[model samples]
Target: MGWITTTWHRLGSPRWFYGMMAPWQTGFGIAALVLLAVGSVWGLVWAPADYQQGDSFRIIYIHVPTVIVAQSAYMTLGAAGLVLLVWRMKMADVAMVAIVPFGMAMTALGLFTGAVWGRPTWGTWWEWTDARLVSTLILLFLYFGLHALRQAIPAAESAARACAVLAIAGLVNIPIIKYSVEWWTTLHQGSTFSMRRINMPAVMYLPLLVNVIGMYCLFGYVMIARMRTEILRRERDTSWVVELVRRPDVR
Candidate 1:
């Protein structure tokens, strides 16, 4: 608890957090690249074709991870919003900004992959009645709403507050998005392999697991990179940021 609180306090200071995260982000950046390469190769070449869907199911390599990250991103945003609302943590606000682009990318990936998968499996590129599809679409709109809100608000503090409010409100859609297939009739299937239960063959699951791990690293890399940029932008007038930017090593 002490460590957690201390870390939180440190993160509240952009200079301290930026200094600490520099090396960590660099490490994750390298890991992200390596994992993405390995996972892509394994999923694309080594994984077996799905018995039901054949080669078309290979899309899962990209689709499943994107879908997973998209949901997780919203949850992260909501958590950040709560922190901002309660503690008024500027770090959390920065976190929310950092997560936006990555979340948007994931949402876009999910939509693209869904369309690609749908073409071969459902004979249509799109479907309106499918709850999962509909919810995912809503998720995309939520990302757009947050992004737009950030831009429209002029003041930094105002932008953070507005984005936090939108994030907290939009959080309601996250659970709905997750449970849409279960709550309503939909073309999308329920999770086949959840953490609570594992029912699939190792051969079929390993590639998915790898892809998921890779995507998680990739998400972290992108989030931290963007966060660093945000820190620099917001702190440009500060002496610490100025000194950091002027460092010989940095240049």
Candidate 2:
């Protein structure tokens, strides 16, 4: 317990955390690239086509993964918010800001791909009444709102606190998004992966699992890189940062 507490405190140090993440970033980045590439190719070519939707269903490989990542990212933001509010961890705030853009992008991609998939399946590009769709758009807006709030506030501490409050409040939407299909009438289907049973076939789901894991790796890689940048920016005036930057291999 003592060691764990000490380690946690050590992680709060920007220099130590940055140095430690270097190897993690490299490993996860390479793994993400390889897994994503392989999974994408396998999903597009080798995976069996859907009986009804056929080739169009292949989009799920990207669509589902992106939506999953988006939701998970928002949850992470909420967790960071909690850390910031309670522990006042600067790294937590950095993490929250660093992940916002990626979360927004994932949400956008999910919506866009859903629309593309919907065009043929539902015969419409947009469905305003769909609970899943509407709720997800709201989630995107939440990301936007958070980002806007951060930029609008000049003081770092104030901005972090404000964003933390918003993030914690916005967590209400996650459960709503998850249970939307069941809670109300909607065109959207229930979860593909469930604890009770697998809803998809092995061939199709295997590649999807691969892509999901790869996407997670990609998210971790990107978040670490972004957090490092945020740390550098925030710590620019600190002696450790100055010394690190002066090193020949700093970049």
Best by lDDT: 2
User: Which regions of candidate 2 fall more than 4 Å away from where they truly are?
Assistant: none
Clashes of each: 0, 0
In model 2, how large is the Cα lDDT of residue 84? 92
What is the C-alpha local distance difference test score of each model?
0.87, 0.93
Off by over 4 Å in 1: none
lDDT of 1 at 184: 94
Candidate 2 residue-wise lDDT, 57-176, digit = tens: 999998998999999999999999999999998889989988999999999999999999999888898889999999999999999999999999999899999999999999999999
Among all candidates shown, the one with the greatest TM-score: 2
RMSD of each candidate relative to the true structure? 1.2, 1.1
Task: Indicate the TM-score of model 2.
Answer: 0.97
Against the true structure, candidate 2 has what lDDT?
0.93
